[model samples]
Target: MGKADPKESYALGTAGRGLDPRAERSRAAALAAASDLLIENGWAGVTHASVAARSGVGRTTLYRHWPEAAMLIQQLLAELFQVEPVERTGELRADLIGELRSFLRVLHNPKSERALRVIIDQAPLDPRYAEVLSACSCKGTDGLREIVDEAKARGGLPKELDTDVAIDHLLGPLVFRRLISGQEFPDQYVPELVDSFLEPLTP
Candidate 1:
């Protein structure tokens, strides 16, 4: 048999300029356009047609990939929230502190914060958006679960503490403080939060 061209091997999917550059560029453009629209008009202003126009991709292509703006925005947030793997660091306090700091940074962004609020506010009226927002939140909670589990393993927390409740205890106050106070949380509060939560759990 004749040796098949190497290009032929990759041609089945994205090979031959069909798969790599064009697809990636289109996806990036869509995300960029969606982000701009989100920041400018909030979630209400993003539509599949608008995104396609702004992204310079065909409306058909956009529809083929993401049928709705909510899905597209969900995808955009998923990309934005991507972070390095959580570090165990062999010290529960350090690990919790690091994760919380990162979380606060993400939640504190004005545009991102506003975007999330819009999704949440619209949830009751739009069930589809609720589902999307719920999925995004669950992804974030999974990250929190990792930190809590690590703390349990390192003997920094009580053996019997329920992880879900423990996570609530740790994070609930910080979120409430942010939303209610409408002020930036001081860096000193992070250690205080860690110390307060850890103190009650330690043997």
Candidate 2:
């Protein structure tokens, strides 16, 4: 499918200073372009020049914000999943379900899912991309760990629950189905999945 053109923005001159609204629009366009390239052509396609051409931002501006493609990829992944932590309601099951639903939504987004697949597929080829993937994975792990910690403190979860293993249990299957089988996790499955994971650990 043909992608839409990037929005028009005021070009920042060499002497431009202060909060240039155009700069924000340019950055947005660059990110959209980079993500599209990632999904369409994989990691090798997301260079500064390619992004600049697609985004209509100058090379100088793209380079000024993102020195490397890896950095740009990192930002792309980060922005796609900028979901806030689910509110803790002192109920472990409900809280976990809330977070799971949010995560599922992000993963199920077509662009985000495609971008993630590209990153994983290219990680073996480029050490820089491997690092970016690791960083993004760590962010997800940390968020899951926080939820586990909160649940434990609330006196419902098992103290022995290994947060790392628990996180893997929660996310691994969803990721497998999304990336490998290319099937969406039905919305009705959220509570079932959450219950299954919690049943083994919740006392």
List the candidate 1 regions with Cα displacement exceeding 4 Å: 1-20, 110-115, 123-128
Q: Whose TM-score is greatest here?
A: 1
Model 1 poorest 10 in a row by lDDT: 9-18
The per-candidate count of clashes, in order, stands at 1, 0
TM-score of candidate 1 against the unseen true structure: 0.75
Full-model lDDT for every candidate: 0.68, 0.71
- Would you give me the overall lDDT of model 1? 0.68
Error of 2 at 164 (Å): 0.6
Please provide, for model 1 over 1-203, each residue's C-alpha lDDT reduced to its tens digit, 9 standing for 90 to 100. 11234334222122223335676588678878888888788877789988988889888877755666666766665444433456667677887887777667657776556556666777788765576567656655676787787667766676677999977876777767776677768778888898898887786
Backbone clash tally (model 2): 0
Candidate 2 lDDT over residue span 1-203, tens digit each: 11222211121121123435787688778988988887788767889999988989999988877777776776676555444466666567787778777677768776666656766876798775576577667655666678888777767787777788888888888888877887767777778988999777755
